[model samples]
Target: MNTSPSPSGAHHVEEGASVRLGALVPLTRPGWVEAGRHLLAGLDLAVTEVNDAGGIGGRPLELVVRDTAADPERAAAAVDDLAGLGVAAVVGEYHSVVARSAAARADALGVPYLCSSAVLDALTEQPTEWVARLAPAQSHGWRIYADFLLGAGRHRIAVVTQPSVYWASGTRILRDHLAARGGTVVELDANELTPEALCDALVDHGATALLLLVGQPEPAVPIVRAVRSDRRLAELLVGAPAGQPEFAEWAAVLGADGAGIPFLRYLPEHLGPLGERVGKELRARLGEAPSFVAFEGWDAVTVLADVLRSHGTDRAAIAGAWPDVAVEGTRGTIRFSRTPGIGVRQWAWPPVQVVDRDPTDADRFRILRTG
Candidate 1:
């Protein structure tokens, strides 16, 4: 058995005896560790349940975990290593840029990759059957968010953005969607401007809503604080389409100030029987309510396990099985199809919601709109 240590830690699993799935998550700094934790919780819970029920055809389902740390180069290297290690397929990745790199590398290496959380529409530059994604495309989800902004009567939108492919794509989506609806989009460089200066720009530009397309804690938190403290922008709506507010860390850091900032989430309004059961189990595993990312992680494994059962661990066989997949996930019936503009096979759309923390109770999420 190959018991080599990974960058994060050592994952012990039977080399040839077990069916292995490579898990790529951001478990370290610069990576959204909270989301990674929830994702891992769901993945672990599903793997445990799968094994308990009688692993893939009596052979144990093993997950070899790797921490991407939100780095694209690091993620690409992990994919290479996982492929070398003979993982049946590679799974999981929260950052779109990182997932894009991993996807390109996996495709080149002929390894099947199921992206869990990255929403970038163009996961791969060219159409390839090797990569598939569970999250709604950035265009799909951001357009819904644009509609939500329009419905709320916020016409003048401002985006606080950084220099990243993911953020740039999101800004472009929002701009095109909103501009077609008689709305305007203004982009403010998060790296160039201080939090206070961003608030000033919001006022100067007469923006009614501001979307944060930047990373957490460093500038996102500071920008929110500056905006909240500035009375001039009292009527302004603070939004995060990237779903930074979905995690407990957002509430822990921003408290009541973080509430009312609508963000995108991929979850149904109400849980079904399986969803309810999974939610309970995930909560117990996570020691708190699970984010939609956790559901994505669980659904990823659930679909993969079903695929492995029907089609063995052959890489090409698994990649070819994407179209035939029809597993009941925690959110809904999961399936993959060729979505136009998205190179990789995609779960057409997961349930998208514009949610925010209830002002009275920061712990409770209030669904403002669904699409």
Candidate 2:
């Protein structure tokens, strides 16, 4: 294996005679580094497995790793750096903002990018033949949440949304989906009100369920605490679609207060055979259970390897072969769909589940529903 550092501070790891692939992740970002580490672990495992299996056309696959630091400009620059490195395809990113910028850059360079975990609805909106996602769009996941709420007979829903494009699009979809099911929605901005005031408003509106669309954990944690503390709102169903990614940390912060709060997740420990194997491998490696982001990283590499094996390492060939590519991934059978309004070249059936925060054990949240 040959390893070198580039001017952009990205590391290139080449093993044997190989087809180089690019991995863009936030390895050193303050808030995102741990997630990036787990993501890299899963990607590395997939690459190792592929190489052990004779790789694509007898050439081992190499990974050129880049740290985006969750910054948009840095992420875009990493794509350019990867293009200069002559990588066959690019995978692995967590933040949606960074993925959006990187997607544009990858498209311009004509390199196939299989997005691992970024869920912004607009990432696939731009006309790009070079980019596809392994994760579902945010709207797709929110729809699952909506179905969960409606099925549970929680009709009077209050939405607490952050001022982000990703949250806005998801909120819009949630609102429409709820309304279609004959449910009422009252929207509130998380940034505009204090947590206390937000709790008061939900109670005043008689909202049976609070749908939090905040994309980050900082605000969602406070809101959850405030809602849980209030006697009047104690019975309200608190749901945060974005909080799934940070559930372990924030749930620990909330302790017993976080119990019964529902959130959407792509993978849980109780998933079937494939999920069990992946989770066990990750646990043995990381000394803890893996997050969905890790599963996404593994699947991203898995899909990319499948594409390269059949289509060769040509960028245009990989791009052309993406639509027909189907692989049984860690989450489910991965397939791309160009459904209008959802985004083009996006995963069609991203499996999502609603899991409640366990009061006693942070790692043992029970799955309520799967969709």
Candidate 3:
């Protein structure tokens, strides 16, 4: 048995008569490469464990990976290609728009897709039995975030946003939820303003909290720096609901400025035995503390492997097994069902929390709130 890199830069293992699961991740630029790396680490670790435990009933379980690169069209095409390759199922995608495209394609092609991390409420325009998701919908998680803000007395919220379907949806969720609760949400367009100008807008709007809804490292890092340095905004709270500050990259770049900026994460207050063991392996594989996204990857495979054992590798059978998934996962007992307004089978939710890096120790996360 040998593992090698494909010409398209995808990683895969091939042995005779293997059971293949196509993996979609953003391994390149314009995508959240750090998140993708952690996600793939968890997926790979689970596959290794599954193989060690008798190779999915003696047929090797292999991951045929394709880089989505955060492109919806590219993800759709990759789904088609993976289907043609006769994969048992397709799994993993960190970007919601890309996952949406992939879900639609997988539905059309009659393939099973277990979405790992994207959390848009509407994964497909129409309901289909082919797709199931592990992430909490935007409405569920963001409302919890809004509540955290409100509880903290940050009633005036501002979101610095870019033009993207995912960001727009998140902003809408925050806006509607906050509005109903007597909180006001102000929107700042990241396209038209420099980091300094954004700071000025934050001051002008009198927003008690500023949430970064834009991409990272470019405008986000600079914006955080500007906000931290500005004397006028010294009392303002900085937030990133999209989980930008979850990775080590945030602290590596911003140092002390990255701390105390709360973000959303899906994790229980305490890991059970399964979670503890997986967390250790994932940490070794990733060379850092694994994020919740990594756990999602591990759980996706754990559920899929259980399905394959009970339902066999048939696409229709695997898709049919969504409602029957009751496997023990790192987070909790994994299951799926029709959530109101969400188009695909959803996990109801993973544990949702508002957490921030400790100001005194950037490496430690303090749980601010849970929902």
Candidate 4:
């Protein structure tokens, strides 16, 4: 029996007999550690419930977690390590850069990968049969935001995008969708200037709204504060297509400045019966409501467990079963799309909401739009 120590720093008692699953998460990174904690909570809950139900094929399921630390190289190495350890499948990742790196490794190793929350369009663009994504691609989310902006009469929009491959790709989609709808877009690189300068540019261009494509909270928090503090851009509607899962945590730092700032979130306040039960369990464990990332992690494990139960623990069997695996998750029906133009093996229907930060309560953000 293999006696290697798991990433959680514990030895698996049923080492060789158990079905091992790799969980890649950012555990120690400054911006992503909190998200990782929440996601891990959901994964733990799912694993417990699955094990309680007699596991898959009467074999216990074990999670071998590896910290990505939000770094691409570290993520790639983690995938290689998981593959070397003979994990049946791998899941749980948040950063798009890390997901891209880990996906490449999973494809190279022929290990089935279920991406949890990474949203870059290019991550699923390639024809990799072993890789499938749970979250909707950035292109899909951007289109929804574009439609909302146009419908809300925000014809003149300014976009501030961070210098990341994920944000850059989303910006292209956002630009195309806005142009197709006859909306004017002024694009600015968030890395090119300070947040104060970016706000000045928005004011000069007479922008009706500002769309932020930064995927993390560190940069987003400061930008929102800068825009809200500036009198010239005080009325400008600022929104982010990413980082909604960390809205409450980041909003706590921004205080009043974060109020009314809109963001795209996947988890709504009202979950269905099953989801409500999961939420209560998570709250009891984590002392707060489960975030969207947490739900994504839980759903990833749930889908993987279902595949394992139906198709044994073989990698090829799991990959083959993914195309037909249809399960109801927290966000609604979970199914992958092979449809052209969006992305291959990507989730098409992820319930997303444009929520505004509540002025009084940082924990309870108000939903502005849902789709």
TM-score of each: 0.95, 0.88, 0.95, 0.91
| Least well predicted 10-residue stretch by lDDT in candidate 3 | 1-10
Candidate 2: minimum summed lDDT over ten consecutive residues — where? Answer: 1-10
Taking all chains together, the TM-score of candidate 1 against the true structure is 0.95
How accurate locally is residue 88 in candidate 1, as Cα lDDT from 0 to 100?
Answer: 85
Query: Least lDDT summed over 10 consecutive residues: which range in candidate 4?
Result: 1-10
Sum up the clashes in candidate 1. 0
Where does candidate 1 stray beyond 4 Å?
1-16
lDDT of 4 by residue, 30-77 (tens): 437778888898898899989999987777889999988889899889
What is the per-residue lDDT of model 2 for residues 32-102, given as tens digits with 9 covering 90 to 100? 77778888989988898899999888888888999998888998988898888878889989888788888
Tens digits of lDDT, candidate 3, 1-371: 01121222132224457999999999997899999999999899999999999977689899999999989999999998987787889999999999999988888777889999999998999888888999999999999999999999999999999999999999999889999999999889999999889988888988899999999876799999999999999999999999999999999999999999999999999999999999999999999999998999999988999998898877777888899999899998889999999989999878999999999999999999999
Please list the Cα RMSD from the true structure of every candidate, rounded to 1 decimal place: 4.8, 5.2, 5.4, 5.0
Better of 2 and 4 by TM-score: 4
Cα lDDT of model 2 overall? Answer: 0.79
> Scored by CA lDDT, what does every candidate get?
0.91, 0.79, 0.90, 0.79
For model 1, residues 42-67, the per-residue Cα lDDT tens digits are 89999999999999889999999999
